[model samples]
Structure formats: C-alpha cells, structure tokens
Target: MTMEFGPDDQIDYDGPVTPYRQLAEILRARIARGDWAPNRAIPSEARLVQEYGPARTTVRRAIKVLVEEGVLFVVPQRGTFVAERSSEDR
Candidate 1:
C-alpha cells in the first residue's frame, strides 16, 4: 500500500512515535509520491530542518534510517538520492 502526505502535514513532536521515525515516514511517503525522482538528490539536511522544524540531528537520523532501508543512498560529497528499486524489490 502506498502512503501519501500533503504539504500541510506536520511532525507531531509530542506524539507517541519518535520525531526521527515520524520524519522518516514522512520522507518515505514523499518519495512514494514522487516528490523526488529516482536517483535525484533530496533536499539538504538544512533545508529539511527548516521545512520540518526538526533539529539537524533528527533530520540526519531520519535520513540514516531511509539509507539503511535502501530507500535512499548517500554520495559523500554530493547528497542523498532516492534508490532505484530493482524488480526484486517489488
């Protein structure tokens, strides 16, 4: 099932889920909705922090989770990009 998030969606700081995990899910939904194309870099951590009102560390943690899940991949000097899913990933 695909999950989608709208522009108005905001992270619930006091919600049961941790902020990092919530940010991760929001990003996952954004990716699934094609906010960023495959292999295209996502917004920088600073931009995300400004947009999501999360701390820099929180944004980094969310990105790390996506990377570990193969949803994203980071290029050291560049930035993070959406992973191009293989047929086996379906």
Candidate 2:
C-alpha cells in the first residue's frame, strides 16, 4: 500500500477519501522520502493548515493517525516529530 506522493501534491477534498486521511498519506510519503528526518519535528499545525487548506482539527486527526501507526511521535510541549526507526523496521 505504498503510494508515491511528491512535496507539491495537493489534497483532493472532494474525493472519496477523507481529507484527514489524505493528509496523513501525504505526510507519510513526505517522511518516507526524507522530507523530514528521523526525530525531526514536522511543521506546526498552523503551517499544515496553511499549506493543505484543512482545518486545525483535520490536521490534528492526521497527526494522530501517524502517531498511532508509530510513524511519528509527539513531545509534551515541543512538537510532533518523525519517529526513529529501528533496524527491524528498515
């Protein structure tokens, strides 16, 4: 289920897939492509909103999905970041 998405990919708001899930896939693609390095913080929610034209809640939902999949993690006050992958994961 690996989809190739580029950095300039735009969201299909009217498509069958939910906006949040589309965003999650886009972010996952970016991470897989090394747009964000391991342990590096992703852009803030506000930035994602600006870039993706999704509401804050939508962005949060996307991030939550990534976190649940172990693709990302969050710090209490810092920010969300790309999770470090172990050898087994690679």
- Predicted model with the maximum lDDT: 2
Task: Name the lDDT of candidate 2.
Answer: 0.91
Query: Which candidate achieves the best TM-score against the true structure?
Result: 2
lDDT of 1 by residue, 5-85 (tens): 453577988877788888999898888778998999999999999999999999999999999999999999999999998
Misplaced by over 4 Å in model 1 are 1-8, 88-90
Residue range 2-90, candidate 2, lDDT tens digits: 45456668888887778888899899889878899999999999999999999999999999999999999999899999999878888
Q: Which stretches of candidate 2 lie over 4 Å from their true place?
A: 1-6
Question: How many residue pairs of model 2 clash at the backbone?
Answer: 0
